[model samples]
Target: MKFSDIIGHEEVRNEFDGLIKIGKISHAHIICGEDGSGKSFIARELAAKILGKTEIKDYADLIEWKINSGKKSISVDQVRSIIEEVNKKPYEGDKKVIIIHDADYITIQGQNALLKTIEEPPRGVFILLLCETMGRLLDTIRSRCQLHKIKKLPKEEMLAFINRKYGVLEDKEIKSILAFSVGVPGKVEDFMENTALKSIRDEVMDTLVSIKNMDYDNIVKCAQKLTEYKELWREVIECFAVYVRDSLIYKETGKEELIINSDKLEDVKKLAMQFSMNRLNRIFDILNFAKSNMESNVSVELTYGTMLFKIQEV
Candidate 1:
């Protein structure tokens, strides 16, 4: 895809374009961003420009390395394979683009194995490391590559994107997806295409809207129903977080334009009135506890039940 096709990050696009135009592009670069923030997509677009191709797919000179199926991290052997391949001349052109996806998952041993190649690659070889975080990378590796971080796109940019791509969807659905996406383009696709995820989003929104008024029996029943959507617990939690955050934002700013759940302006306004700042903060604490518990393999049913009760208490 063209850089112009990207949703945002005008500054980064301009800088990279300028660097490429002047033939001063770095041999190795690190593109860091949140997970599913399209770091690799941006890198691929840049690579396409560098190689004078409209796309990199099926291109002989473009190589990609990622954690394979059943693999937890990039192994040293996998890193070595790319290292050896970088020594070869480009297949079609003078330049080669090697993209390593999920580079944050590269084991310390794997990073060490690939350091030499990344530090001093053969002529015309460029490495693009796409990662969610750079904490796992060594200082040596970090210093060697030019780093470009991807930030959340502007609300306008994000709105324009979903409007153009998903114009057929209802306004409320679009807004809900937009709120959940939080300016991350890659995630928009996931929510749009997954019916179950959309259902879970609806359930979460419904729960948040009704929780305060829910009787004890209803609260327990609601929590139990959520257990059936076990695999989508993260999405459920994020939906809660985003909705509550929107309520908090509305309460403080009293501006619908500033809230992510703009389509739910009336509901959000009501939500904001029901909870004080202290109550909202306590709700956040409950969310954090629920998230931590889920990650720790705690009982999902128990976790949801407790979270619902705690939220009611506040």
Candidate 2:
């Protein structure tokens, strides 16, 4: 994809284009961002431009590395192999490009093995590292690369992009997706393609409503059901958090337009009446904790159980 095809980050696109035009590209670069925030896409686009190819995979000079299936970390052997390949002359293009997807997955040993190559590659070698965050990488490795952070698009830009790419959606539907997507196009696309996501969102709302009066057995069942969606726990918690925030907004202002979940006005109204502002804030905190814990590989059932119990208490 061309730079213009990217939805947002115009400044970043322009900077990369300018660098390419000046022929002053760096030897090693890190493209860091949240998952689904378009780091990989931008890396591929920049690589294609650098190699003068329409597609990155079609360019013979490109060497890509990622964590192998069922593998937790990228082994040192993998990094060494890329180092060996980059030491050779380019096959087709003037510069050989190495892309390491999920660079955070590279173990300390692996990063050490690749450190020299990144610091002083062959004359015509360039490397791109894509990662969710720089915290997992070594300071030495990070210090060697020029870092660029990718951020989510603005609300208006993201809305326009979804409308242009997909068919027009209702304003409320668009807002609903945007609220959960946090302006990430990949997330918006996934919510659009997977009808089940909407269903799960509805289930989250239902569970929230039920938690107000649920007995211990029912609470256990609800937590168990949520565990079944462990892979989507992040999105689920985000959706619930938004719902709680919207409920508070509606309660404080009595303005339906001010809330994100406009389509769920009735539910919002019911929840606003049932919950005080302080309680809503507490519930939001609980949901946020669950989301954070999920990132740390916490037990899904226990996390949900704790959140449900805390919300019930609130």
Candidate 3:
């Protein structure tokens, strides 16, 4: 994908081009943005330009040499391999590109291995580093590179992207997905692909409704049903997040257009009336923790049971 194809971040795109146009492109650049704001996409796009592969191919194709900087650290082994690749010289383009995704995942050793090269980069070698937070990066690494920041797309552009990709969804569906997706396009795609996400969303609302009416047993049943599938538990957490977010928007703007759980706005309104902000925040925190733990192989039963008990307290 080229800069023109990136859906948003006009300013950043222009900055990127200007650097290339002047033939003074930085050897190392740190591209930082929130999750799903397309940091990796932009990195690959820049690499394509450097490698003289401008045509857009399948997303999967661009990931041919992709390496995961495992767990919170980019291995020194990966850094050495990248250095070896660059030493082969530019094959067909003006520059050779090394695009390192998740720069924050690079360990101190990896960063140290990279420092001398970054400080005195070879002619025709361009490095693009992508991260969510520059603060997490070593200052020595940050000092050698230029930083480009991208923001989440505005709602209109985000919705337009969804429409362009998936056509016009039902208004309620659009609101619900957009609100909960936190303006992340990848998450929006995931929401669209999973047909069961909607039903699971309704179940989350139902659980909230049960909480509203003091139907304690239904809350337990809701948790039990969610544990039936790992994916279902994730959906419950996602929808629940959107549900609370919609409540915040409802309390602030009173606009239905911004409500994520549009079909269950009334239920949200009722619960919003009943729950304190602190209560909502606490539940969201717990669910987020559960998601993190689940990713690390926490048992489904344990995750759901803990979540239900916490929600019961609320």
Best by TM-score: 1
lDDT tens per residue, model 1, 1-314: 44557677878878888999899999999999987786777888888887878753457888888898999899999888889888989988899989999888888999999899998899999999998889888998999999999998877888888877877778777777887789888778888888887777678878877888999999889899899888889888888888899889988888788888776778788779889978988899999999999979999999999999999889
Candidate 1 vs candidate 2: the lDDT winner is: 1
lDDT tens digits, residue span 142-173, model 2: 99999999988988888878887887888778
lDDT of 3: 0.74
lDDT of each: 0.86, 0.85, 0.74
Error of 3 at 81 (Å): 0.8
Local distance difference test, candidate 2: 0.85
TM-scores of the models, in the order given: 0.88, 0.87, 0.81
Q: What is the lDDT of residue 77 in candidate 3?
A: 86
lDDT of 3 by residue, 28-140 (tens): 89999977788777777766755556654443223223446345467888788777766665655546777777778777898899888878777878778888899878999
The segments of candidate 2 whose C-alpha lies over 4 angstroms from its true place after superposition are 54-57, 245-258, 265-281, 292-298
Model 3 alpha-carbon miss at residue 297, Å: 4.5
Reference-based lDDT, residue 6, model 3? 71
For every model shown, the clashing-pair count is 0, 0, 2
Worst 10 residues of 3 by lDDT: 58-67
Ordering by TM-score: 1, 2, 3
* Model 1 misplaced regions, further than 4 Å: 1-4, 54-56, 167-169, 213-217
Q: Point to the candidate with the largest lDDT.
A: 1
